[model samples]
Target chain A: MSKITSLADLKKKRDELKGGLDIRVKAIDPDSVVQVKVAMATCGIASGAKTVMEFFLEQLERRNIAAIVTQTGCMGYCYAEPTIEVKLPGQDPVVYGFVDLKRADQIIEKYIKTGELVDGIIPVNYQTIDFKE
Target chain B: MSKYSMHLLVCGGTGCHASESDAIVCNLRDELEAKGLMDTVQVILTGCFGFCEKGPIVKVMPDNTFYVQVKPEDAQTIIEEHVIKGRKVTRLLYQDPVSKEMISDSKHMGFFKKQLRIVLRNCGFINPENIDEYIARDGYQALGKVLSEMTPEQVIKEVRDSGQRGRGGGGFPTGLKWEIASKNKADQKYVVCNADEGDPGAFMDRSVLEGDPHSVLEAMAICGYSIGASHGLIYIRAEYPLAIARLKIAIKQARNMVCWAIRFSAQSTVLILNFAMEQEHLYAVKKQH
Candidate 1:
């Protein structure tokens, strides 16, 4: 709350603020936060990626879920337009295809909340640039 | 849950500010308040996003939607269509010139796709006036790291290893220069910063000063500590009134940060501009403002 006057104060301030910034940090360390990314390229938007993104953004708040909802360029699932990648804390990411409003609701309710696998789970054909536990 | 659900980051860089970006912020806030979403949303004015071609850029948080070439009148449409209805205004999206495709994310835009930000990293992200925002992004962490962790020789060694060059006419390695200065023995030492860009349309130094003044101040203090100098003097031209004002504020703020590691007993090592600006140019820039 006060100005950081010394080295110890700077360290304390960094540690305090690091909690709020963990999600945006360049290094991805899986912890208590869930990450939900909506594919929002040209074809993805043509297939209602906007609505799906909005649902995730709003519903997560409504249900008191701690999540970071973001939009990425594309996940290369044009055939299954409006795909979403959800990674719960400490779990590998899962990409779901053909995600409509109903499917998005199921994701927040079943997959994200209850930790149950839902329908429409598309097998991810690619891996992230960095492999994490 | 956080009180605000979203943050609307608007570009307030000089180029965008001149293009009615402030008006866009006002209009957006008014529209949000009318819709009772003001409490749920915050509109923040930030420095340049480096895409001056697309002046007045508005970026929505959480989802990373970048709206380019935004106008004051478009604020209402942005609120109703994008903020409320959850749809991006197609026209405002940055359009790729080659294929004529609309790009929702700024990162994918060609202008920023390949660029790596060094000095301008926090320029567009944080409100320049706020020092706390700058600190949150590790603004003076390097200064602290040097002060608490390393000796002057160690600092010079690290800088030498990095091989960072000064952004001046002559490409001088900064560490070697500091090492040379530290090696010389003198009763009194001084670190002078040349902020004079005599050529017209030279705003690189000015932009950095305006957008992220703390960075300059921190670097100056580091230079002071490294060169065994007790005083730091910045000789800037007077035509840059905005930069001058920002530097004053930054210098004041940095002084408040007590030195804990090694006393920069360099008693408040601050020296403002030497007033080398041409009188005619000062009057011209003042009139333009």
Candidate 2:
């Protein structure tokens, strides 16, 4: 992907993909769906999240998986470049550390395809604190 | 199944990449293959995992051993001891600057133990572009609920009640903004996400927009319905080329689902939607009350 030079080009590319794009809707049957999240924070990008994100999009499209790909800001784990979280509906979401194109492929093939937990997971570090208190 | 396996995830984030994270990745692959451990081990290059001060980081899987401040030269030893013999390289573990203890896992470290990730919920967990992974996490449920059972007013009420003040600095009540926009008499009102997050050291909105754009999209539509606006605008900064590109992709995806008709309006100025709520009508209604 070359640098997007203008908003018009951006719109043009979006329009071209419009017909093929598959945005996820709220699953009436949530049990059937899978969710993948890529960290797109500055830290993530400075870490190469762009490439990681692109790889997942391409793989998902090729595999014909009915999943929704999304981006989120920093998770504060800046040391873990290209972080990704996976949620296999009804199971707790797990955060995977240090993801790239190759790891993404394995994740898609193994975790997303076979539902087997693979390597590269960062253990839960923080406890949720109620800020209101 | 292999008797023993190790997966090495190398940090490919720009900072580390600039510091030869890519070279380190290549070297790891070469050394792993040279040691004939390629079949038993896997070396993967991944996006930023944060903790950027420690560049060229690697996490060995299964045991989840995190190694920080790795160099291209160290890849050989990592392959020899860690990958070949399954020995933990204690020297490479992340040492807390404060505690001075070599912390092997990110969870036990103070840097990772104090944050709550609601908006950043999915980052560093799944591939950013895979939707199934998102669906597995209940990604679009909010949008579905809003579209099916809740009226726009009800959606607005929920957001208002959720206590999610705008993360965009001003702390303006998001629900109230929707309420005002909903009351507006414009035939075409707009809902805008201020992805032009310009705060110093602030990448919150960018990460939300990047990692879980659907949440923002779902939230935006909920806002649109609440405010009776069918059109949406995302005012992202020009500085973030990657974020802009991803957001464009997200908008197209959103359109495919018929969630919202979105337009990317590129401008450097702070974005403020001109549509005003029908103030006179609200005041008149208040008078009647």
Candidate 3:
């Protein structure tokens, strides 16, 4: 690490370092940011969930979308090993099954950006107690 | 800024360390490695979270899940349930004493909700060991701004106008003190930071030093710039081993950044002397006295 010679250099250093802690900053009001949760159980990992998760983490930031990518247990879709659930602010979370890098990109560009429902969505088969009650 | 989507911040404060937070860190790393999710998740040992009563605390970022009293053995459960499944460990969540309801977020906690953190703003938030993390939070920006934009008189006036007072019980105006010190015409001047907390149960300074040592160092540098002192001395107690260790690391990193470097701003030479590092010199002074 070189010494910051001037104020401009310090500001540049700060900007370069900001991305490292961006997730924590966005997490403050999680309801306000795009929340992406990739299922990462044994079956999920076996089906390339790790790659899918990494793609979202890298792509969302690179694309300038405010998103929080996290890992979740099995979504009970073993057939779709690398399944992901994306919850946009003020909308119901949509679970997309068999999510590859291409599917994830489509989800971000189409479903996330334009709200156009893509083909791979796993319809909600079960309801929580909030719905049951 | 690596592609890590998740962050697990384990409290590395003395209080948490006593409860074996180091073992928790190791166990968490081992579990993450076993699951092959190491690249996706980043585990950082952070300073005090200020909730030492319920520590050792392990806070998960990007979701803001606060887990308290985290045991080393529970690392597997955190990785399996929280990190892997997106489900929070209810057993580890800080339950409200009154409602008995599990509070996952630290912001909503009864203890932290009402309090606004100023000086301790970056305490539990950033990795104290990593200078990049500190810089990410605008750590030395204040010093840079003061050095680049303001004159010594302007800096002192700004501090005075802000109604900033010394933390000491006397409530002395800090700007006035600086003015007084600056008026003294001497060949050599010294800005002394009193870090020796002798009052019983007073751990504020220690916490600040341990949690955010760079902030203290930056403030010292700012004071040096304001009072026209080329040399700064931090009179800290040897009892605070963790604070001392962190100060040494922070000083080294800041020196690398050139803010704490002997030639600060490339125009002035402000050397911050860590008294803990020069025990022999202090001993010599004491023997002479």
Best by TM-score: 3
Q: Which ten residues in a row have the lowest lDDT in candidate 2 chain B?
A: B269-278
Give the alpha carbon lDDT tens digit for every residue of A42-73 in model 2: 78988899688777766776687856555556
Task: Mark the 10 consecutive residues where model 3 chain B has the least summed lDDT.
Answer: B262-271
Candidate 3: C-alpha lDDT = 0.82
Off by over 4 Å in 2: A1-133, B1-48, B60-62, B71-85, B252-289
Residues B165-227, candidate 1, lDDT per residue (tens digit)? 988778899899999999999976767877777777766776787688788777776776776
Maximum-lDDT candidate: 3
In order, the B-chain TM-scores come to 0.82, 0.71, 0.89
Weakest lDDT window of 10 consecutive positions for candidate 1 chain B: B260-269
Q: Give the alpha carbon lDDT tens digit for every residue of A90-120 in model 1.
A: 8989999999999999999999999999999
Of the pair 1 and 3, which is ahead by TM-score?
3
Tell me the tens digit of each residue's lDDT in model 3 across A1-133.
8767666778899999998888778887899988999998889999999899889888888898998888888889999778999999999999999888889999999988989989799999987754222
- Complex DockQ per candidate: 0.14, 0.03, 0.52
Tens digits of per-residue lDDT for model 2, B155-264: 88888898768765489997788788888798677786777766698766765655555566666666765777665677777776545555555555544433223344
